[model samples]
Target: MKIPIRSECLPYALILSFLSIIFYFLNKYIAILMLILLAFVLFFFRDPERTIPFDEKSFLSPADGKVIDICEIEENEFFKSKAIKVSIFLSLFNIHVNRSPISGKVTYKKYRPGKYLPAFKSHASEINEKNIIGIENEYTKVLVSQITGFVARRIVCWSKIGDTLKQGERFGLIKFGSCTEIIMPIDTEIKVKIGDTVKGGLTVIGVIK
Candidate 1:
């Protein structure tokens, strides 16, 4: 059977597995603890396939989490206009993999290093370490921000500027709990509200009007 875990997990899995084996020979109880951690590492990195919707006008959620905030904001960084921002807060148990919300060519990419705070805090979005990616289809442009939380320090993005990405394609992941924000045109018809649970690539976040 194919391993459902992301490839980025192999090194951590191998290290934990090796430590568990070595501890087994020296201390049984410690070995058991290592084994438990190994299981958690596997679970945390699991990447199951998702069914992406085919509608061209709807944009999917970029991360699996709960919608924490949705409001109008002036997106001067990319869109440079009034836009709707939807923020998703991912817990430790939520899937960390991030997906593209629409099929488009990567037009912008920027990485900012900053403070680490709890992702649920409103100010965290502005001060936390983050990677910003802008995908533009023929119709509209969408920006995805992967923000690191107190426990999440690593942000991985595989797609780069000028690369073409299909709707719901895997692009990157946060190493632990984090936050993801999607900024769309002001005319976008928001489909999710705050506190709504969402699945990356599976939940329609908004409709392009």
Candidate 2:
């Protein structure tokens, strides 16, 4: 059991636990409270412990949640244009680790510090705390934005702007609960529909054009 616990955490479990303990002892009462909060954060941000089974040949869902929306939006990244937007909403109980949807080189990565809105609200995409990752795959470009919800306070992204990523690779994690938006080329086919439940690194949400 202890082995499995350590395995799931990769190399960060000990560090996280050690910090949690130190924090707990420094402010016993507050630290105890934070430890409980940390436990919930660990649980919610937990990454699934299985291979997605898809080779670098297929596109995968970047998040584990429900597809709340699919729309067209004005992309302000490079060209300052419009693109098809696919939004996935992560609830407090949903896993918050985000994966790369397709193999590509990250072209743009920016973080916007903003307000924490309810993930279910329509304005959350624009007004909420979020981090955006734009990738260029061959001839196609896509944007994946991690948006924070009311209960979410932290967003973690591991990939740099010039780093290369394979399909379904773990690229980032959002603490607590939040939402993510994937913007694809206008011609890209959306494989998942609104209300469909998706799992990170496992479910197919779209394909590169």
Candidate 3:
């Protein structure tokens, strides 16, 4: 199969490859190192297709990574009600592409500036820079947040308020390793737990009741 890379990464890959070529004429060892780095960057932006769940009540994962946290917290920013937050921490090796958890219209979108902490930490959810998206249909409202980790500084989000998104459709990507969170209704059933591995748009994270 062809390498499934994101178009957003082409500029980055090109610049790095050019540098790698120039360095190759000067020092073979340094050029090899640059090539390796280029490979990693290419891998980081890979966007593979996933089979989305068809269940009307199922809420798919918004990102690919290990579940770092699962808890019930007060969501004052958007829902203004209690919600079950599921945080997924993406490692460098995991796909950084983000997808919609369900088919709906984006009702809310916001970007916050803050400190860059390790995403695996619980505190990072509150202090780190992030982008929050709220999607809603006639059925329900769900919120998903894209958080930047210590190594991830750029968060790209294509979703905007009033835009429609299909379940498991690619919406954006975070550069390098980071975290993404899904806030579902507390009454929804939680399928995964802390430390569980999940694939974005593929894993059924919760069920709508």
| Residue range 76-149, candidate 2, lDDT tens digits | 76537877888898888887788988888998988999998888799998788889898776656778899988
Q: State each model's C-alpha RMSD to the native.
A: 1.2, 4.5, 1.0
**Model 3 C-alpha lDDT per residue in residues 81-158, reported as the tens digit of each score:** 999999999999999999999999998999999889998888998899999999998888899999999999999998
Worst 10 residues of 1 by lDDT: 1-10
Q: Which residue pairs clash within candidate 3?
A: none
Give the winner by lDDT: 1
Say which candidate scores most in TM-score: 3
TM-scores vs. true structure, each candidate: 0.96, 0.79, 0.97
lDDT, residue 56, model 2? 48
The TM-score that candidate 1 achieves is: 0.96
lDDT (0 to 1) per candidate: 0.94, 0.78, 0.90
Candidate 3 residue 122 Cα shift, in angstroms, is 1.1
